[model samples]
Target: MNCPKCRAGKLQGITLKTKQGAALGLDQCSICGGVWFDRGELEGYLSGAVEVLDSPSLHPKLAVELDHCEASCPRCAKPLAKSKAPQSPRIQGDACAACGGLWLDAGETGGIALAEKVNAAFDSWLAGLKPKA
Candidate 1:
């Protein structure tokens, strides 16, 4: 499948290894650093549980110029609608209504990861304040 953001970059299958030793198959754009996540895949990736093995850390470029052309779903050819990244309202991404696939532009995935960490830390801190049962 081709990248939804950068039409020129072909989507390549990348296997992400989780801390638990499980492998998750994901697609990434070699040129633009965007990632395509199918239904349910984004949750696992944003959980801080997934990591790439023997791969260079993803340094998403923040200055990439997005193609103004409407992004579409590579899987189903449906027009992708803009939506906020899960659990991260500040980060926006594209979602396919028909297929439930998501297209996150360069640097947005990193933002989501950071948001997840912040949310986790806040939850932990909040939990500590609860009255003893």
Candidate 2:
């Protein structure tokens, strides 16, 4: 599959292993460093604590800027719907409404995973401060 963002970038299939030894496979853009995750794959990786953003192979410097318009799903060949994450609106995400797949720009996985961790920690701390009944 060709990269939706880079247009010319080839989508390379790679397997990412979580800390728990769970393996998830996805496609990544060799040019723009974006990732294409099938439905539930991103959630599974994050839940299992997969550290991937720091990988140099996944993030390569590109000579051209990424283009978002007209991006389509490599799986179903349908247009991708762009939106910001509800938990972290600053980070943009793309999804295939047809296939339920998700697309994230380079470094977005780290941002999302970090946010999840921080939110979990905050919730735990807040719960600990609640008055005993």
Candidate with maximal lDDT: 1
Question: What does candidate 1's lDDT look like per residue over 1-133, in tens digits?
Answer: 8878768889889888777778788888877778888998877776545663232234344234563458889999999988876655676788898988888876667776676778889999999999999
Candidate 2 overall lDDT versus native: 0.74
Residue 66 local lDDT, model 2: 48
Per-candidate TM-score against the hidden true structure:
0.77, 0.77
Q: Which sections of candidate 2 miss by over 4 Å?
A: 55-67, 84-91, 131-133
Error of 2 at 61 (Å): 12
RMSD of 2: 3.6
Model 1 lDDT on a 0 to 1 scale: 0.75
Best by TM-score: 1
Native-to-model Cα distance after best TM-score fit, residue 51 in candidate 1, in Å: 1.9
lDDT of 2 at 65: 42
* Model 2 lDDT tens row, 75-94: 99999988764434755688
